[model samples]
Target: MKCWCGKVLIIDTRRLESKFRDDGKDGLIEGVNLKDRIERNMNASSYPFRVDDSCHIFRFTSTGMKTIEKVVVFDPLPIPGIYMLVLGDFDEDEIDVGVKSNNRDLEMVLSTVVKIIAFFLSDYPDASIFVEGSSAARNRLYRIMIEKERKNWRELFVIKGIDEDTFEVFQSGKNYSSYLISLCKT
Candidate 1:
């Protein structure tokens, strides 16, 4: 499959129906599945962000015979703080947040995270924030929360810290989520 952003997204479903049945999970939504199929057929793709160490845009070409020429490129966002948040899907969770960016400024990192949580919670009111790995991660996040509160930034109402790897996978589509999350750890 491909996204309009010109990035190839392939998900073979040769056994998906059987697997869903075996797991006793609800069937896939018809429109969503069809959309995925169309995306694959169209060979849509995108690279919303730049890949580090590369001067070129990420190109996603379809394996099929489609004249669809989708080009994906990176766009750097300016939030006046550390880190960036990208959205993606996971098998185990409905929503996940990852911190990405090497910027060591702790204040910017926390502010970015709070902004992400606030944005997501507006739609996913029941979503949880999962911090991964380090035991002290909770304490670090809390400290940032307190500081943000003092600075008059709205406190996030939902957060669950998990491990580093899980956050990494959820943030696969987003390149900056984990880097900022790591800044909070330090």
Candidate 2:
């Protein structure tokens, strides 16, 4: 599928296991890193896609402010799959989410990921592109931002569950999300 963001993309969200590797002195694949193979086809002649494997933690300035206010760098995880699992926060009311996704075609996935991110770019946006076993699924959730719903929407992230915790994090975020992470195994 192709998006009007001057890029063409494709997603093949197939459940696959790969050797997990990270940035360290010794190069080794410790355990099997689960992945959903989603490929993005970029038509742009030159696009910068070197910003992968970086985690951004969005912290709020206020106690109950929606959306991401501040972003911070955090420790990199060994795993790759996009785990939206919730961890207890320093403050009980606050919630912390760690995001990471295993990459097969890094450029394509990241490019397409930028488009999928548009879904959360609005004040009240409801849409999701998911990877479900070798295919991309698009669910027109709530009121859409764009006039017409995306017909050729592609999957950028392969997720496990759309639980309440995950929903809360996404919904609470303003225009950007701190829970999103892009990881690369070097």
Candidate 3:
């Protein structure tokens, strides 16, 4: 299947299923160094998270001025090995990506999302994750965060920025409409 960035992805479903079954025996797939995933200098504090049976959804809570529930979903795209990283507030059994929580914990919330990404990649190392903000402002926020930690993340991930039908290696000063990230082949 062709991803939005025009890259073709061919996945082996049987291999993925077998790997999942083997690693999920304990109800969790392990293989990432969570402590090293985020930069310490960035105030990268995170909340505890819970994962659903399928491991596609992760839930956590944000606390500051007010308590707000949040969820990160790894929704699979039509292509087998491609997934979208969705971050949103969980409200009344629905996910509202555009909701402004006003919780005053953007760093912590983003840290939690990064941790979730680490966990998800541990299970599907070869899979590509697509990320785009719900709005232009949010997109800028994401770009800023990525720029701040680009060097720190380079060892673990291959990050590509999408600009109008072109995908290029992520650069600090360049702005991108979206991003694609995958585990770096060792």
Candidate 4:
């Protein structure tokens, strides 16, 4: 099957902060990283933050599609902090978030992810998105994807436990589920 995904672009935490700084935003305060601010606010200097809150915007250009790939954090996220967007052929749009251990960032990135899909839908012609997460986290991933799809596309996008489940639910529609998860050593 021809994949709807195209190019991938990762905007890390540092980059987002830099963008905010350049854009004259204020969320990234005091030149201090969000992770540090959270830690300081809790008065737990060594306390680990929940997860890196980053935006994963998917942009479909007239040439190719683009998506986020990494998050730069001081205390690196235990989740897939480093993501390598594997470009695929016309058959599928593959984004391999090389997750060696846990997938804490997966859920956090979903909100931004949906918008990217929306970009594809509203902006691109006959556009769709395909997600491939590890089986360990596919359930949660599927849940979030499904919720977003349902809200936007109604039953038009039935993302279930896996990609197949999603495909089975709504065939010939926007297939937005994962086929496999990535395992990284680094």
**Model 1 TM-score on a 0 to 1 scale:** 0.27
Candidate that scores best on lDDT? 3
Give lDDT for model 3: 0.73
lDDT (10s digit) by residue, model 3, range 128-170: 8999987778878888877766666677778899978889988
Ranking by TM-score: 3, 4, 1, 2
Q: What is the C-alpha RMSD of each candidate to the true structure, in Å?
A: 18.0, 18.7, 9.1, 15.9
Question: lDDT by residue for model 1 over 1-186, one digit each (tens)?
Answer: 444567875655444224222232353211212223222322113211211122112222222232221222223345433222333222222212232222333343344334333333333343333332223554455444533353232122322233445333222122222222221111
Better of 1 and 4 by lDDT: 4
Task: Report the lDDT tens digits of candidate 2 across residue range 1-186.
Answer: 443565865633231101112352233311112111221222312111111122122121222222221222233244443333121122222223322222223233323333323322221122232221211111211112111222222232222233325433233212222233222112
Model 4, 58-142: lDDT tens digits are 2211111323343222222234332322221111233324433233444334433333333223322232334454553554555
Best by TM-score: 3
Tell me the deviation in Å of residue 38 in model 3.
6.3
Candidates' C-alpha lDDT: 0.30, 0.25, 0.73, 0.32
Supply candidate 4's per-residue lDDT for 33: 36
Native-vs-model 2 lDDT? 0.25
